[model samples]
Target: MPELLSPRIDAISFRQLRLFESVGRLCSVRRGSEECNLSQPAVTQSLAKLEQMIGVELFERRPSGSYLTPLGRILYSRVVRMLKQMVTALFELEVPGGQVGAEAIVHRLTRSQVRSLVAIIEHGTFAAAAAALQITEGSLQRAARDLECNLRKNILFRSADGVIVTPAGIACGRRMSLALQEIDWAINEIDVARDIGESRIVIGALPFGGSVLLASMLDEFLATQSKVDVRIATESTSEMMQLLRDGKVDLVIGLTQETVGDDLVSQTLAETPYEVVARRGHPLTGQSHVNHEDLIKYDWVVGMPNSNRRNCFDRLFIDGPKPRTPIATSALLFIRHLLAGSNRLTLMTSYELQHETMLVRVPIDVPLPCPTIGITTRADWLPTALHRDFINLIKSRVNTRSIMGVTRTAA
Candidate 1:
């Protein structure tokens, strides 16, 4: 994407976006004029003005007809999605017994102003935010000031330390962020609609799910939807939750926990039973029975502190003295390597240790509690068609038959 310079966001209207979309779809300005019920000259002028506002040549005018340039295709996709959403919103407002005359509260601020407010809130400093947005400090400050004046509230204040968002400002910024997400989602939706080979999804996964569960499902999804791009991040639950709230990730998959905040929605897919695993040649590998007392003697390798696996491990030994200091990490490959080369034990779901011939599960009669593994997404998120399809594929891959016998535990 390029840095779009102004005529200001207010200059760009829904009408212009709609016209552009029609022209791009039909590949003829005359047909677009007919579709939009405007004269051909008016449609052509509106498109020219839109291009000038965004500082991009949306189409190439040849003898045959007007064909979209690369930038035009991008703009057309976004416009179509935005128009669809606007129509949907209007329909929702017009539902029976609904507030018939209700309309969106018009703000005096421009899109750039709202974007500036959100950027400042996210970056925490005017200079840094301006740099990120490719705008000058003066312009950003003026936009922020204009926003505060329009809202009739002090959105930000300068402190000795730095600029701080006021309580009201925080609330406003959150709404703006969500609105920005809607715009982004509109673009993603259009990409999916065009089948342009550029759709994308970002997923955050915990250690176990990323390594075992998501790995297989993603392979299947990509094989069929090869045009869709997928990026995966493995991080702690808290960190991933923050990313989800910030709209940096589309969804998260992992063991479910009671600590999840109200902003997220979780659906249990399956129950994953855990095992105490050690290197194949470790002293405890072939033992007839392994108890907590016997397991405490060896050094241990565990997930990062406060992680689901680590917390469960701690609870299993709550009555006994704490085991010797263990190597703490979240990297599965590193854990596998450490366990293979040293006298250490680690707890893992059977799925996690499935392909590792160097590691073996210690035979123990004591039943360790199983955790419910599932998918988590933002409560207010509206998925595009592709996103919904991908989610369905994941659900199909979950082994529902095994969930009944496993004991669920709070992580």
Candidate 2:
């Protein structure tokens, strides 16, 4: 039987792929030239070479503007995925002693090579990307040629305006990147365990957690562990999620409630009671009894409006649309400062307010609804032994410490 598709894969140069990806992204020859810092003719030559190799026109040109052809569009999507994988690998390499060195020999891709792939994805022109790297476009072209020969596939497609990515190109980049990450992580796991009988675990906490329970618990946990490396970084709740997703840190301890998203796995760690606090002798403090009605009258310094705390506050005061005259909302420290210096009231978890000198809880008898704190990790990444141990440590602390002004047993 005759072969319906080409039995042999077409050859594509990495430079050509870079050039095509650039043209596809930028959408114009002149822009591609300016970005690549190449003479228009040079970019044209690269695109032409790519088209010749692929046996397809990857883009369509019109008077209004240039766009990818159907085939080209498919390729562009693939290229984007591939480039993301390449960038992910480079980010991993920044960590000291990742597995890239040993496994890289088999793939013959250095960190620079991985970065170059990303540059092509970002800038979309070989000349532009090469200029950014301070190397000759011809040098980049040669590198692509070498990569294509090794892969044995026409990884890039091209046309008059720019280049397009092929499915094969995208798949190869993604597979290679994932392989590199797993390898690096595996090596790190071994090194961490070998250095200590138990692996040294790293935890990233949100600013709220950093200032309160997490800080005290971290110190106690480290004291108990003879061999462990624990790192605590303060960031916003959303940023903590990103770090966990990327596996840059083992677990996140914060006020964020867990939700199922792309690759994230959330476990409810605890519920923290919240309350409104104000400076001593403030108007709310003077009231014989504090009530939600009176509490809403003052401009509150609150968590960001969309956060669970703020959202709950909104619901609590739902009868009257949050009297928009003016209210303050910010991260914990700003709220703390406002509460310390002025009569401005702010809502905080009991743990956060425990150490403050100037702030006192209002007399409102209602239980300020609590926000759930949780630990999250990428769903695809199974928790390591060390990761589980760190989680247990958090649970133990919650069991002992007062998160919402009451001990765990009482709550």
- Alpha-carbon runs more than 4 Å astray in model 1: 1-106, 401-411
What lDDT would candidate 1 get against the real structure? 0.71
Give the Cα error of residue 385 in candidate 1, in Å: 1.3
**Per-residue CA lDDT of candidate 1, range 1-411, in tens?**
111222244467656767788889998999989987899999999999987766668899987889998757766665555444433333342422333321222213367777788888888899989998889999999988886665545668889978778765665566556544554554444445556426678889887655577887777888888676688877877798888877788888888766777878998887767788888767776577888788889888887777888887887788887677558887888888988898888888755655466787887667787888888898767776678888899888877554333322111
Best by TM-score: 1
State the displacement of the C-alpha of residue 7, model 2, in Å, after optimal TM-score superposition.
37
How big is the positional error of residue 133 in model 1, measured in Å on the Cα after superposition? 2.3
Q: Relative to the true structure, how large is the alpha-carbon lDDT of every model?
A: 0.71, 0.59
TM-score of each: 0.73, 0.57
